[model samples]
Target: MRKPVLTIFYQFNPWHSTIGGVQTVVSNFIKYAPDEFEVRLVGTSNDPAQPNGKWQEAELAGRKLQFMPLFTLQNDNFRSLVPTTLKYTAALIGHCFASDFMHFHRLEPSLATLHWSGDKTLFIHNDIQKQMQSQENANAILWRRFPQAYFQLESLLVKQFNQILSCNSESVKLYQQKYPTIADRVAFIKNTVDSQTFCPLSLEEQQEKRVALTQKLELPANTQFILFAGRLHPQKDPLLLVRAISALTDLNVHLLIAGDGELATDVRLEVERLGLSKRITMLGSVIQAELTKLHQATNVFVLSSAYEGLPLVVLEALACGTPVVTTNCGEISKLLPANCGVICEERTPVAVADALRQVLLHAENYPIEACVRATEPYSASTVVGAVYSDMWHRWKQQNLVSTVQKCSTNFT
Candidate 1:
């Protein structure tokens, strides 16, 4: 029997990039999706050289998957909404006809194509209103002027989709309260990590890897490493981490930032301004393997994001047996087991610095085993993948029943 076609629409291209959380989630879903379903992705590309309107075949977990880049947005900071919507809507209308089920990662891309009918799912990764509010405060006067318009769009999306997938309990609760009529449609599917690859290292192994990484980056030995691995965006607040590091005058610590983004230059300037250029290293956009090693080598992973869905890096760090010091953003505080790490009360530099210092002082009490054990329920193959499988089966059965009822009514 031919398999059902599942097409996903998102903002980032999943070809060979490892920049954003959405891309990581989409890539993992494609990797772990049941073999009985055929998967395809429609997204935007940052590479100006990538040709538009082309289907590229790639293999994941021994299965073939197709990707179509509808448009190229050279500058990542540019949000040319009208042009992006027009080009993507035309591309989706032309190519998405054969899909039995559609999955959308963001609301903006799905706005123009809402007229297309199918069994559709919308995965809400972050609170759209909160994010828009933050954007308006930082930049984008348009968001401030027409905030209600954005809320209306979000409400329309919530009402239109057949199913809503939320990454955390907080989002699920928020949606349930806002759209009580469709509360049953919202489900939680936590983010996952590859447990095998990100597993804890032995003492000797950690020391060896630490030495190699330090030497590779030209840092001294016997120094404590604290890692922050995400885009240097306003939402992530990478400069906060730098400020916290600068305040720790008495500790022999080094901060390693392992990603780049819109605020890269600003982050660098902040590091220099704080006179932490030597104490901090900015490793811009390392591959997955390097990230895993960095997690294993570090004493603590820090997440200073103003908000999030459920960060995959936090799970990955826990899987590697590294503790965390993070703000109470998203469901991270709830997800963290006691003694696995520290959850700050606020996102200020003083709070983060205090949390990091405490974690560093008693780091040995938070065992590697404890960190790894906390992540057992979030393993990619066993837990996360099974949830997706169950969702697909349930939705398919519901659709079948609805179709049968329609036919019966027509015959009557």
Candidate 2:
């Protein structure tokens, strides 16, 4: 028999949304969910044009999707916290009633709601409180609303869930470290990728595309190509990448940074200041297909982010058989095996540039098989299966029947 359906509720900010790891995981689950499970998406709207409304179901990527436009408080400042959170809480209340199983990505509605009913599964990507606690005072208010309310609320919500899914072992450990009593509740399932669609391009194809890209971007033939794809934000630290490139004077390398954000202008300014305009090509916001081409064309893929929760780009780059240069963040050690990439000790321009030069100079010495194999367990189907397995195991332990009607629901 097919397992019962599970409804995932999230307030998706679509317009500013990039195809990052979390979104990719959700999409991948929808694509290859178990036969016994019916996946329903309930996303909150970010449309300023239409704010006051309830959640509605629709089709996203040919899957059943539900989007709700709730009254949201736009600014992260103090005044809007309570009202905006209440709005989100109301939407979640509606979602809770509709869903057989509720999986929450964000803390807003979950924190606000009094009742924690049904087979609940909480997905905590990062320690939001821990992250916020470290931030400046201005940002701290956005982190904790109803500080007194949350005092008991977090404990209540944590106990209410049948299981809690974390992105990596590191995250799981963090949760265990904080809440040792609920150690059994926390589980780890790393993010996945679409292997068939995201696999490496042929050498000839890569070279051909590289030639076209070189001509289109006016890139020099002698210059070694290095790719940095992601948002140009403080979180991403793209300017640091420019500074890194600037420091790499000995190497004839050209950096192709793809993506734009709040730090876009700042990154450009840094490029100018360092006189790295010739060495760096800021190809702002290229689509996925083009991104694949860029990954294939590049000698090494680099991620210089200050922090991350298992970035999908790193996986994508590996799937494309491209070597990587990244800062030691999150579970990157688990992701990058052997010679697939180099992990820097710190997030500095000098550190990044030194790693970049080394990787580019002897890129071929890295294990190609290791690079490709690193992404094997993280394919869309494999990842989706793992998620179902974890959920099913939890359901079985709790002696609950899967409501969906597919017979191939066994975790094995």
Candidate 3:
């Protein structure tokens, strides 16, 4: 028997980029998927070195995966509209028609899959409608002002999918509320982390890492570290974290921010303005190994995002045996075990500061063992790949039955 082909559509090249959460999710899925399934990815790339419209084979999770670039749209703006979208849609339709089943990583690319008559699933990684309302970009502003138009478009695209994989229960609720008719189609599948790579270190190992990191980063000995790792965009509310740190003047804590984005300059200015330059260190975008080390050495991980689709960083932190202080976003509140961390009711600076203060005060109560255990379900080996495999089988079976029904009707 031949293995089923699962083709995924997303804009960014996952093999090349590790910048966004979507990229991370795609990488993980492709890396951890079962060997019985043949995974293929279709996307656009800006890299001038990579030839467009060619299928390239790459190794991920010790498995061979294929990548086909639909077009070479170097500019981000053009990649979504006009001739670019048309060309992409044409290429994607052809690929979808050839594949056994299709998977989409974002709303925009999923739109192209609608043209193909095949079993398809859309993975909701973010609340698009919510994001538009909060973002200040010109396109987001337009969508916010004309939400009805946006909703109509969204509803049309969503209704086309045979199945919708929501990253969290919150997303499933949001989608069901928006499209009640498709309520049965929406299912919650939480994001995952590499537990082995992010597992907690022993006491001696932790001490050695802390001492080494302190010496290398030139930080004060015995100072507590609070880490925030993600893009410094408005949605992430990186400044709110900085303000929260400023409010904790009494505590001997240092805020370590990893990753850079549009608001990088503003974040730096905020740190300078609040006189937190000495208290906060901005380590612009570290690699995965370094990030794991940072999580291991940190006293607590902090995420002050206004919204999310279940951040992988939170899971990564927990897997590293570090507690968290985060806002109530996505399914984070549900995933966090009791005594594992603090969840802020509000996204304001004051609320975040209070939560951080509380967590810092009783940090020992959130044991490393508890944090590690809480993340058992989200490990790549345990849940993510298995859930994906089951979904694929279910959707494929449904598609086969529908095809047989259509044949019978034609014969009659």
Candidate 4:
């Protein structure tokens, strides 16, 4: 039997060397994709050579990844928009002509998928337009930078995919509402964690790791550590975290933000102006091991994202048996079981601070075991299995449909 072909496309810049949720998602997919399927990953980033050509291909584990470098000219505003779109669209059309089925992973590729007539599946990680606009306050100014024609082109291209897979129910509902014609095609598949890498650490292990981490960072034990781990983008609302820390005067809570982005300097200034210089530590970026240790050490894990499909950090914190304080954005409320974590009010510093205090002070109310158990369904194997199953089922259905049509034509 011919192996079902899977093609994943995205814009990934690993050289920046910072860990974020999208990076985790792609890495996890690459990590867990089954051997039975023939996988091809195509993506672009800051790769300089052969800017308009397919740079190279590599075998990661058992899967194949093709990294194509899209050339962008300096001072050319329509490079990623028109040129990248045309190149990726050509690539997808070529893949469609060769492959039995296609699993797309980004808006850029989705545009191409729409143009190519094939068995297509799209994985929705976030509301891309909302996410783009979120960086409006930051230097991105995505809308201002990208021409209005780009949105029209993207919207036009998105309508062509045969199936859509979203990471959360909220995304599904929102997209269904936004694009009612494709409501039936939208499917729900949640993100997963690698249980082997994210399993429960022993009490002794937790204590030892936490102590070592705090010692390395020189943070005091008495200080309430509020951990925020992700890119310091405007969407993440890093300033709100600093503002929340500034609000708490009664407690010796010290905030540790473990990530980097465009707003890092602005956030640091906010921390200083609030007189929280001593209480805040911007660890910039840390490795996965250190992040796990920080999770184990932290009293509260907070995410202040303006929006999210479903955050991996929240799942990671739960796996570490740490309580979380996050906004209602993302599928957070659904992820937060009866005793998992605290859901903060929408986008307000006072509300987030108040929610943080509640979780920190009443930490006992949140059962650590339950939260850990809640994350089991999101294990990498489980989640990847879901993705594989859906793609396989769709591929079979498309084949059956084609066979039936062929038989009908023969009879006629």
Candidate 5:
């Protein structure tokens, strides 16, 4: 009796470098897999130090973590996608055939290797329609029309998936409306947070962690920190968060930015340009453990993304009992409440700054209990258990293989 093989594919290397939302989701599946399943990871070696187009593997959580290295333009422009898709296909040739179920974080890999796998699940972290249009303000007509062109191709690729999951209900609705053919396949599943790992501490613990974090930043004691965690990408707009923080001229306030990507240099320059060198600290590529600490210690968490599909950072922050001030991107307005977090309808720095100021000035309003309670429905135990169990049940019903069909869906 062989356990069913499942390969969770993300687009970044969790083995070497820090990962973003999509990678983190894939990692979560790997982390909480049921004992009856043999979980595997397929990610790209996105670091510069790694060799390009090379197949690499390492052990993660007692499973094989494979890397498909591909180096292209830092911005992930259209020029790079063709070769990137081809490379992903080549890398997944063996894994696709060996695995019973293939779960993908990015569509390009699955689209290219569709013929290689029988059971395919395409998890939607970013809505392709929104992502393609996110940067449409670029100063070219071709760029404006690019989203529609990409969406047309993506529409064709999407119908090939066995399942399409998203955390954002709006994204689910959009998919159902745009492509009714695959409407039954698309469903909204809530994102999960490890409440035990990201829980709030007592007042004394918070104070102690805050003091230590402040010292680590080389800042004076008792500094009020605003934390932003996301990739330095145009969609994330770390620059917007920097600008918002710069406008908060309060001497007690400081901003800590975590994560790294293409716009890292641009964000640094924007911070310097705003004369916020002292007020802002760039904590590049902080791992999940440290990120949980940041969420616990910070006064408020913020996100200024142009678009998203219910960011994991926000859920992690809430689970840590940190109130958030976020622009109404993705499902932020729906995911956050007035007590748990502040949602800004306006996307400008001034508006975001005001939201930050309001949260900072009135921290008592967003109680730690309320913030933590908001995230109760998103507990990892419930959500992850449901995901793995649901998939297992489906696999059994479909009889992907005779051996796996006999396995019970109950957590083994």
Candidate 6:
């Protein structure tokens, strides 16, 4: 029998490098795709070699998955809008023609899935309405300024998808309220990580990693690190983290930031003004291996984001036996067990400082064993692959039943 073909389309490249949680999700979905399916992935590429207004496949000599990209996706200015839209629309339409099942990411390309007469699903990674309030990135600006238009767009788009899988449970409920007709179709599914690649180190290995961390961050060997690994944007609230660090009386506690974004300069300026230059190390964007090491090395992982949708970094850190201190965002509260997490009730510097201080003061209470346990339920291999496979099988069975019913009526 010919296996059902699964085609996934997104707006960013997830196969090559780590960009954010959305890209991470895309890569994991590809990695853990069902055994009975033939998978195809398509995303945007900014490579200069890719010709304009064309969809081209990437060189898969050493790559994990083959990819095709619409070259004009990056520059979203008025001039390139028509060509970019045409390229991705044509590419997705073509892929749909040959596909039995489809998974889509991002808003526009996902909306294009409506053009296809196949089984399709869309995954929600964030609470769009709340994220717009943050105006954290360029994309959020338009939503924030024109709230009515944003709501209309969401109401329209959510109606198109056959099923909507959301990372945050809260987001699922929110979607239910926003679109009552599609409430039954909206479901909660947690984002996952590879626990094997991000597991905790042994005591001796931990000591060595700390020593290595000291050299990498140019800090004291015995320093207790608090790591934050996300874009340095207002939504992530990196500056709030900087302020929280300044509020902390513990001189031994240091913050290691592992990303760069629009607010990078502001973060640097804030760190300098607060005289936290020595206490904070802005590592910028590091590779996944180095980030895994950072997760393994740090005393605690922290996120001061204004909003989220079950962030991957938190799971990765927990999988590496690192405790977390984050604001109540996404479905994060569910992952953190007692003493294994320090969730700030408020999004203030004082609240964050207090949580950080608590974890640093009573480090033994937050054991590596408990931290690792928190991430067990969200393993990608076990959860992501199985979920998609089951969904596709059910949809295919439904289609078969419908076809048989139509045939019986015509024959009679």
- Give the candidates in order of lDDT, highest first: 1, 3, 6, 5, 4, 2
Q: Where does candidate 4 stray beyond 4 Å?
A: 13-18, 45-98, 127-141, 144-151, 397-412
Clashing pairs in 5: none
Candidates' lDDT values, in order? 0.79, 0.70, 0.79, 0.72, 0.76, 0.77
**Displacement of the residue 125 alpha carbon in candidate 4, Å:** 2.2
TM-scores of all models?
0.90, 0.82, 0.88, 0.83, 0.85, 0.88
Q: How would you encode candidate 4's per-residue C-alpha lDDT over 21-70 as one tens digit per residue?
A: 76677767776877777665565445344354454666554556554534
How many Å off is the CA of 157 in candidate 1?
A: 2.6
Error of 1 at 63 (Å): 2.8
Judge candidate 6 at residue 34 and give its lDDT: 60
Summing lDDT over every window of 10 consecutive residues in candidate 6, give the lowest-scoring window.
72-81
Q: What order do candidates take by TM-score, descending?
A: 1, 6, 3, 5, 4, 2
> Candidate 1 — which pairs collide?
none
Q: Which predicted model would earn the best lDDT?
A: 1
- The lDDT, on a scale of 0 to 1, for candidate 3 is 0.79
User: Which is better, 1 or 2, measured by TM-score?
Assistant: 1
lDDT of 6 by residue, 105-173 (tens): 666565556566666777888866578676455452445666788677667776777788888887788
The positional error of residue 190 in candidate 6, measured at the CA in angstroms, is 1.2
Q: For residues 349-412, what per-residue lDDT tens digits would candidate 3 score against the true structure? A: 8899898888888978999999999898888776667766686677578768989999999999
Best by TM-score: 1
What's every prediction's RMSD, in angstroms?
3.0, 5.7, 3.7, 4.4, 5.2, 3.7
Residue-pair clashes per candidate: 0, 15, 0, 2, 0, 0
When 3 and 6 are scored with lDDT, the better candidate is 3
TM-score, prediction 5: 0.85
